[model samples]
Target: MAGIYLRGKTWWGRVQKDGQDLRQSLETRSESVARGRLKVWLDELEALAWGGKPRLTVNAAMDEFQKEHGPTLRPSTVRRYGVSIDHLDAFLGDKLLLTVRSSDLKDFETARRTAGASAPTVRRDLACLSTVFGFAIEKEWADINPVIPFLRQRAKRGLRESPPRTRYLTRAEEARLIESALPYVADAILFAIYTGLRQEEQFSLTWEQVDLARKHVTISAETAKGKRERTVILLAPALAVLKRIPRHLKSPFVFHHGAATTTRGARRALPSASTKKDNDGERFNHLDRGLRNAAKRAKVPLLRWHDLRRTHGCRLLQEEKWTLEMVRDQLGHRSVVQTERSYAFLEVEDRRMAAHGPGTNPGTAAAQEIDNATGEPIAAQKPAQGRRTDLEKLKKSTA
Candidate 1:
């Protein structure tokens, strides 16, 4: 038999079974409602003690899921997951794990959208929740993964078109950017352009990575974006930049700016630091600001810092005439598809040129007829006569 006591408006039960006393709270403001709820709760507890289902809270399940699978992810990936979970915890705190419905997820999606998160960003957060719940279902922590089905259907319908991707720096813009950057930053920019090294890779580059005699740079797995080791063949321009670097046998960094040493607590600090002028660590920001100012001064289009990398890829595609595979290897891309996706514009321009053929204009049919009658390519004819004049002068000078 069970004894029930009324505490305020709620009822609590105390039952003695097998020499053990068990307590259960019936959460209700009405004594009659609490009494009815307590009877059902006791039955459920008895069934659970004899191999029935046990309910879990959202917080407990998430904690369990994280403990089991969190270590497999990379540090950066783990940080991103933590951020997403924080948002979910804020919304669904105190809810039972199995009680969360698809409608709750939809409401959360709406709230996040109203708060100005992009669709892609929201999708990624939802993906984290979906994965967590999926794992919970696998572990028998929850009967169904509410986030999974919602994510699949919602993701397709809610997909937003991403921002336009930008690539490449125009010649004049490149020149102005180089001229404006501080000496060390200019060197770093040139290194990035020539080597196609990512910003983090450039920052963490060591003297060991460079082979001056071989004219190559070996990027380690830890520094590379793809998590794979690769080597970049350094051209003469890239080599020249490397040669100009003031090497210290003791210092490991390739570009150890004075600003970095002073502010970042490098062993050898810079002397006579200025409050107005940036130190070595802050020099990158100054260089970025300088580029913006230079773009304004030159009346050029706005360019991002990453435009240098795009310029490198575009130069390889256009000037060097490197194959897509070659560009992929040089840029350390994980897949050729990534390279093509990023630089397919170059291929489009090439195809357009090929379709029209060189020196032919659709708007100038008469000019094309004149060129056809001349029996010469329009661009080659002028250069040929100029070369003839130079050849005659050269023969006269030799005689």
Candidate 2:
């Protein structure tokens, strides 16, 4: 049996079940509404006691989930999930799992946003909370999942999402950045720009993964963020960077000492300075700061290692020789949409170039005569047959 009570202006229901108490807000002011909710809650509690499905405290489900799950995920990922769990536990307190409502989740979002949390950050926490709820459902500790419904109905994607970055380096900016950086840092920037490898892939790069003869570098599943193995085809510039990297006796890492600061003469005397690395992922993890410092010196805009990866993706996708499918695979993205979101900076660049470009529109030349500035009849300009042949030859050579 259940009892209904008027709490302030709202209704709440409480029932005794399996020697424990279940309580939740009915969220109504009317007496009839309170009694109706009490009846339904009593029915549910009776079913639960009769072995319909057990329930859990939010804390209990999270504990069991962390203990039971083992997917060989990255250490950073484990830490991130732990952080999300900590936030959820703090917010939930001793709340029961099944009583979580979509409204409660919406309240949490409003509170977090008020406290300066971005939508993406709140979304991540919700996703982790949903995972915990899913685990509870899997163990039959809860009959319903609350988070998924909330995410779908309450916070559809793009609520307060920060804009995706479109800042990729131009060739001249890249050259200036490279020249401004230290030797090892410069090599890393060049390699990342050419290979489209993420920062972790770059940090975890080892001699074992590189095959000079095969012209490829294999990123193992453990080292890659997507937990999938991928092979990056090495171009001539990448190969040149590889050949020039000085290997040392202390480490087998491909890129070491990104923060290495030594005069050329001193570096020559102590070749181990270049290889004086932990040879682990922990070392040089903060290489972005080094790049920023070099950017300050070079007078280029502050650039991240990821921007180089984007630059590579944009360049490859813009090239006439490479197919979009090929670029998507090379970027190691799960979908073309992911590739476009990150590297589609080129879309705007190309459009701007074409609109104000030096030449007449090739497609429009033979189709019809139209004014460039206004929609009016004008003399049609025809490109010569030889000029078209020259364009074909250039495309063939580039391809």
lDDT of 1 by residue, 185-298 (tens): 567778878888776677677778999999999998876767799999887778998897666555577766442211112244322332334334321322465455544543
Positional deviation of residue 31's Cα in model 1 after best superposition, in angstroms: 21
RMSD to truth, every model: 14.9, 15.7
Those runs of model 1 whose alpha carbons end farther than 4 Å from true positions after fitting are 1-79, 93-99, 131-148, 161-164, 248-251, 257-302, 355-399
Model 2 clashing-pair count: 0
Which residues of candidate 2, in runs, are more than 4 Å off? 1-54, 156-160, 265-283, 340-342, 358-399
The TM-score between candidate 1 and the true structure equals 0.62
What lDDT score is found at residue 135 in candidate 2?
82
